[model samples]
Target: MARVKQKGGLIGCGFFAHNHLHAWQEIEGAEIVALCDRDEKRLKEAGEKFGIANLYTDAAKMLASEKLDFVDIATTVATHRPLVELAAKAGVAVICQKPFAETLSDAQAMVDACKTADVPLMVHENFRWQSPIRAVRAVLDAGTLGDIFWGRVSFRSAYDVFSGQPYLATEERFIIQDLGIHILDIARFLFGDVAQLSATTRRVNPAIRGEDVATILLDHETGATSICDCSYATQQPEELFPQTLVEIDGSKGTLRLGANYQMIVHADGQTQTLDVSPKLHAWARRPWHNIQESVFNIERHWTDCLNSGHEPETSGADNLKTMALVFAAYESAAADQKAIDVRRMA
Candidate 1:
């Protein structure tokens, strides 16, 4: 693939950085010229794995030394604001991982910084880009699911997220911030802006500091109601029910995405099933590999936006609504399921 006019760098070479590295290599008109991490060991290891010779322990040093058009921050939630602000200030476009920030104000600040710098900032909220989810969005856009009034986006699994990223277990916000944010963002993406939100959160695992399970009810401006549930304690059979499923009911039809990327649509007096799972890759052999592969689609989108001067799907300003939804869920849970106004939160 030919390189784009603009070359990019990657900050924070952690568990998810490998996905970004692979995706960038696969995309045309994009090249990762440098990689940075706080830990020299991790930085060196990632550079070697990806064949990137330019490595730095300090992001500021990397940004100063490398002439990059963009930077992807794959670091933890705590580091997002500072890294994004730094990149924007350096006149580099940014692709940040979720949750956009630890708080709404910080998220807003990051977005504002990018806007002030006239550089693009996109949140890597990739759930909506999953093949099955994208297919569902296509169906809705085609008016097959006419005027959806009720919907449910659910993710439940016993997978141990704490093993690889234990920091998630100690965070003040749990599933709602870490996992539910993706589901909530998907709802907002497929539906529209939320009007109100009510939620409940519980720390199902005593070992974890924050809530490991959460359920949120949303009222969208389009009069569509959505229920979003995320949990790390769900003990369902992974074979029959693989964590992510969405059920949408419309005035005239219904669409359901079942386990293992199965899409079932009931409309026009007939039923149809669409296999929308992503194509298999060598690195994506595990059961939960799709989640990692979806990041590639998002990275490709980012590169395309940079090349064509278009906005990515998950722009920072657009993702502020998603961040607000996460905060609203936390506020609603604290208020004992009292509905929180989305507009007032802003």
Candidate 2:
């Protein structure tokens, strides 16, 4: 049976939104019917490029006028709550970008709005959708890793992220808030809900306002401990920019996701090496192809969930736990890296 394509309206035609637009074009169950942005030039450029004639400079106007099934809020953190509430008010589902809100209260409000309106709300937490990450999860699920006790999710690189998104350099919160949120979420995805968290952050790059280095320790509810470390200040020989390297140790053996998307697993007296690189989409380029592919994967998942009337894996309510970890990390860092009880905070 051919399902009717779900109508989607995308807000914020900014730097990262291009990937959303490109991925939407490839989605069979959904299509972005309208585009909105305060910047007229970017809006028109996106509309013309994507052949989306229904365009608006105001999101409210777009929501009131277009009969969309869902609104994809790809804007920055500050605007998420209002946009999400607006979408919910219009009786439409929402897919909000990460760093869900400036605070957990606002995120809860948005989640409540969607629940009140009987609409599905998903957060665009795409790191877990990455192919290599999924492959790593597959090993854990296979139980070959066996009673995972310790792990590390590391994304250390000297990549100049500010080159494409200059606003990142000016923000008071950097690596942890922007990039580490994804890494932390990945930690929760691979392990489980964190019980306690402690973090130490430092501003190694004098050029940026926020810390470019952060190492967070997590105590999972499953009695497992893991470290989520990120550093944009670290310069490596091969430069594993935009790549998340993971290592997990269990009762049986260990699994490692190294540079170049290589995965090595050892268990039961056997070791297997495999390449778990993401497929390079037609519109994607090197280095960014993995992220771009994950964008498509997650968007497709959103449509699937909508069609099946099932909740998304990274729904608003589920993401609150991830958001809790983000806030807890900052709280821990500020309190001299004190270990925080995550469940109490959440």
Candidate 3:
């Protein structure tokens, strides 16, 4: 039997969208048949580079003309809700990029739209899909580290991200909104849903308009407390750019995911060290490869879910919790680091 590929259309040809485009090419059960971007130059360039023929400057025209099974929305936060709603209105499934909406109400509206349209909607929150992160998750699932009680998810680097995405430097909410969202999602992925959250932020980079550093404290529903901290201002001897380091302490023992993808687990009176690294795909580069591979992983998961009629692990409904944590962090920071009830916000 031949596998029928799901037809996909990609919107927003931007810096990070290229990774989505490249990863879609490698996906087994999906193909990006049409491209849409308001910028004609970027749309044409992406179509030429990827050998896509169907191109459009308007998304509605593309959605109405093409019989797409799903739309991969790689647009910025400002456009996510509209694009997702458009796709849902067309009865097409949607896989939108992270920071899925500007607010919880908007996120819920998008989710409701898809639900009413009977279409699957997934948020492309891919950090938890990284191979190294999955490895740590596997350990937890296998009961290797029993009864997780405490953890820390940290991503500290002095990398020059502005060189690639200059707009990030100008966002009113930088680290927590752009970077810490992923770290916070990972905390939820590893520990569980958050019940309470408190945070503090700092503007280390005077040139930027938003905070470049943030630390968040999460009280998980499972009674596990965790910290998610992200910084682009730290000048360290070893720069672990794009790498997420983790520490997990459980009833039996502890686990540490250090730099260079090193994961150490100690349990039952024994310590085990493992190398957990992401695969470098043909179209991926170093440092960014971890994230690139996760793009592939999550997209592959989308295709599988579409085929199997399974709800994605990071569906819009699920992402609301993560987004709640993001907003709650900001609220906490603004309120003098006071704890905010995450469930109420979500």
Candidate 4:
């Protein structure tokens, strides 16, 4: 018997949604049958570019009418709850963009709605799905690095992000909510669930409304400690816009992922360097290729999980833990570097 293709509808056709559209085009078992965006001009532009004729201005209208297996909500954080609830009521799976919610209560409600509907819910957090990060996890799993004790996941760039997403500059919270979510998730992915967290933040870029710098310390349940730091104010001779540099120390060895996708593992007096760069898909451009590839990887993961009836790695339930860290970091920073117990957030 041949496998069935899952027909999905995409909402919010602005900026980053383009990547989602392109990624869905290449996914084998999925097809985007409909698109909905509040902005008529953007909807028309994206519909024309992707040759998608099924477009709507209202998401409720799309869900009420289209026979969809899933709905991908690419809208901003404020709209997540209502859109997710709408999808849940429609009995369709949902994949939401991160940061998942403005508040933990909303996050819990969205998760509960999906649970009540018995439909899959995934947050489109693509950082860990980045090939280099996957390679790092492979190294850890293979025991080449032995029992991992400490790690650092860092993303610092002075690249002009506001040029594309101008709205980001005006948001109340910047790096942590936007970029740090991914880095913190990477820390969780490598080090395990966090038991406690401490953080500090500062707004270095006067041009933006939120902090451009954040440093968070995580004490993992696995008895490992890790640091997740991000800065949009750091400038270097070579700009690593979308690169996430990682360093890990273990019982037996150490691992380092440097700029230009160079990954190195050192153990037992031996060292290996490999290029873990992401492949440039036909529609992908430079600098953004890594993130673009991850968009594709995560969408494929969603389809595979949807088809197999398996929970996604970043499922709504699992993302709650990651989402906790995000809230904890901000709370910690606000309380003057107080250590926060992750459990107390609920």
Which 10 residues in a row give candidate 4 its minimum summed lDDT?
A: 337-346
Error of 3 at 141 (Å): 0.7
Q: Per-residue alpha-carbon lDDT of model 3 for 31-76, expressed as tens digits?
A: 9999999999999999999999999999999999999999999889
After superposition on all C-alphas, the RMSD of every candidate to the true structure, in Å, is 1.5, 0.7, 0.7, 0.8
**lDDT score of residue 221 within candidate 3:** 95
- Model 2 weakest lDDT span, ten residues long: 233-242
TM-score of 4: 0.99
Off by over 4 Å in 2: none
What C-alpha lDDT does candidate 1 achieve relative to the native structure? 0.88
Which ranges in model 3 have alpha carbons more than 4 Å from their true place? Answer: none
The 10 consecutive residues of candidate 1 with the worst lDDT sum are 235-244
Better of 1 and 3 by lDDT: 3
- Candidate 2: tens digits of C-alpha lDDT, residues 1-346: 7889999999999999999999999999999999999999999999999999999999999998999999999999999998999999999999999989888899899999999999999999999999999999999998998899999999999998999999899999999889999999999999999999999999999988998999999999999999999999998889988999999999999999999999999999999999999999999988999999999999999999999999999999999999999999999999999999999867
Q: All candidates' TM-scores?
A: 0.97, 0.99, 0.99, 0.99
